[model samples]
Target: MAAKLFSPLRLRGLELKNRIVVSPMCEYSSQDGFANDWHLVHLGSRAVGGAGLIIFEATAVSPEGRITPDDLGIWKDEHIEMLKRITSFIESQGSVAGVQLAHAGRKASTSSPWKGGVKVPEDQGGWQTVAPSALPFSDAYPMPVALDEAGIQKVLDDFRAATKRCLQAGFKVIEIHAAHGYLLHEFFSPLSNQRTDQYGGSFENRIRLLLEVVAAVREIWPTDHPLFVRISATDWTEGGWSIEDSVALANVLKTKDVDLIDASTGGNVPNARIPVGPGYQVEFAARIRQETGIPTGAVGIITDAQQAETILENNQADLIIMAREFLRDPYFPLHAAQELGADVPWPVQYERAKRHK
Candidate 1:
């Protein structure tokens, strides 16, 4: 029997050679959103390592949407050339390239994780952050200006324009970063949105923006390409966005032609207790997949070849999105193929290292 981990999975017109995916991770290495040599090597190595799909980190749709000064940006057309270079290399390695377009909302304008990760002041190039409501992520974070109707339209416009740039950059997949307590998640969770307008105070209202964003991008995005939305299945706190909400949202997203729900949880709240462990979040992906009948991607601490294989074999998720593990070992997929006895090809340059069983 063939190993499921190495099996090809199709989404729209794109066919991934395997289920292993490099989840979008913030590198905080870009300047003015330009993809430098660091990004090329960082993403290209994963392709050489044999990941079927490599999604670039949370790329800000606008300057104000950046989480830190160094966060990647796609707000301008000039950024497309460098990104195109990276995507071309990824495709040459038989790996599909994906980009996660994001807006950090109240979490914007912070220092990099390695540099204290604190809110940067306006004098230091930081600008005012905006959210669905005028609430700060925490007392330590900046208080964001609540987006009025005009501000909301700008957000939608930013996403639409960014989607166009991603297409121009030759990205095969486009994942909307709606999870991890970002702008979209903030609107989805009542804990952050305190508005009484049409965009708040009800389930349909709160999710209005995300639905509109998907619709707008779909209009510009080719029907042959797959569109993905990452969502936090739960806030890990009472009266917050719940798994049931995620299921309901998934059902709605399916109607909008979303290809997959990248299931992740806990980031909308600062102190929501979570049971962190290997595959701790897989159950959410499994549940969302089962309930919504939409293909889901399981992320968070999914290490080891057998562990990823088990999730696929059980029909829990259609994709295994790995983050930190990929950081520790870019060649994880190549090694996994060897361990699982799957006959995956190795880069010719590194074929000498291929193990024989």
Candidate 2:
């Protein structure tokens, strides 16, 4: 039988009621790493609206790993309480809750997009960013400190600790953020990673840290819960991290217990040309999934019901993860189910809204 968008799919022991996953979109609404009512309502509304899985934004594994200091964090045990609340409400709505664990690395300490997203100064809440090499994201950004071997281990330890906190917070899926020219992407792309150590240089050396981080995270995360790794399928620049490289990395990740690759591209370089449009990045997901035989999530500009259904119908990806679309219509899954003539339960409170005259 062909799998449809509304059909349940299981990865490891985690069962998603449908193919629609709310991709992690940063709210930038946290205060001191604590989730608040904004998160509660933001996540809960999506679950109520009928997304099969709701993934929280790229949450930092350590204080310095945050893109902006105001970004969400799970570096401490105290951050778990509010996250649990959001998860509990999501599960109540019959949606599985997932969280993307991230480390911004050299890309850390920028102003929020609303606040111009420029390089924040040290006194004004910015801190020293670290990366595979001493290179900064841009001349406007701080010159990052190269992570020593011990520092690299500390980052891995942070990811491990964050995974433990995620389990306590009741996240059913844990996604390691390794894409978008953040810390991990910095390592993968030669444009940013110019180093002589084992963590950088050739393809194998450059990809080493990310593989190690995944292994460390998998050790702490439960075998029953799904583990996903988000990767930039391409750096979208000449002589940069290419889709071919991503395919090879995905193949390696499969053996490391990575359940899915949330395939999205670009973020490491500034002002690189990206051919953005509807389903712009889906091709990368399709290629990676086909090349590696790994369950992959297709994200970026996936809006319409027909487009999403086609993605699944063609086996382009195992899951369709929507971002801005879900924000625009929290009930997108229910509306899509109706539009595509698929059976999906409407929230009982809104059952009257589902009538056909």
Candidate 3:
């Protein structure tokens, strides 16, 4: 019997060679949202490492949507060429290229984690952040401006435009960043959203913006390509966005033609106590998959080969997405195949290092 971890899985027109996915991690190396050598090497090495999918980190759909000044962006036409170069290399290595279209919302204007991660003031080139309400993420974060009707429309438009750019860059998959208390998550979680308007106050209203963004992106995204939505599943606090809310949202997303739910959890609040451990969030993925009958990708602390294989064999998730693990070992898939006694091909140039059983 073969390990399910190395099994091929198809989503829409894209057929992954294996179930291992390189989850998007912020490199914070770009200047004005441009992809440079650092991005090329960072992502290219993973493709060579044999990941079936390589999702570029939270790429902002507009200038103000960036999490930091150094975050990647797809807000302009000039950004396409550089992204195209990167995607071409990924595909050449037999890895499907994907980008996470995102808007940081209230989390915008912060410095990169290395630079103390503080919020940059408006006078110092940072713009005022916007959210469903005027609340700031914390005292250290800036108070965001409440997005009115026009502002909301702008967000939708930005997503649509960004989808077009992703296609132009030859990306095979698109994942909407609705997780980790970003713009979309902020709107969906009751903890952060307190508006009484059409886009707030109730479950349906709270998810309105994300639904609208998905619908807009779907309109521009080709039918052959797969679309993914990442959600935090739970806010881990009372009265916050719960796993029940995530299931309901997943059902709704299936109706809108979403391919998979990247089930992650807990980034909507500043002080929610989360029980973080190895495969801790896998239960959320399993429940959402079983309850909604939607394909989900399990993330968070999934570090071992057997753990990933068990999740797939038990039918918990269809895809295994790993972040920090990939950072630690860029060739995780190649190594995992050896550990599981699966014979997966290594990059021809690096075949000298291939293990002999």
What lDDT tens digits, residue by residue, belong to model 3 across residues 1-357?
999999999998889999999998999999999999999999999999999999999999999999999999999999999999999999999999999999999999999999999999999878899999999999999899999999999999999999999999989999999999999999998889989999989899999999999999999999989999999999999999999999999999999989999999988888989999999999999999999999999999999899999999999999999999999999999999999999999889999889664
* Pairs of colliding residues, candidate 3: none
lDDT of each: 0.95, 0.92, 0.95
Worst 10 residues of 3 by lDDT: 348-357
Q: Write the residue-wise lDDT of candidate 1 on 1-357 in tens digits.
A: 889999999999999999999999999999988889999999999999999999999999999999999999999999999999999999999999999999999999999999999999999988899999988999889889999989989998999999899899999999999999999999999999999999999999999999999988898899999999999999999999999999999999999989999999989899999999999999999999998899999998998999999999999999999999999999999999888889889989988889653
Residue 186: error of model 3 in Å? 0.8
Going through the candidates in order, what is the number of backbone clashes in each? 0, 1, 0
User: Model 2: per-residue lDDT, tens digit, 23-42?
Assistant: 99988888788899999999
- Model 2, residue 298: C-alpha shift (Å): 0.7
Task: State the number of backbone clashes in model 3.
Answer: 0
What stretches of model 2 exceed 4 Å from their correct place? 1-3
Residue 103's lDDT in candidate 3: 96
Q: In candidate 1, how many clashes are counted?
A: 0
Instruction: For each candidate, give its TM-score against the true structure.
Output: 0.99, 0.98, 0.99
Candidate 3 error regions (>4 Å): none
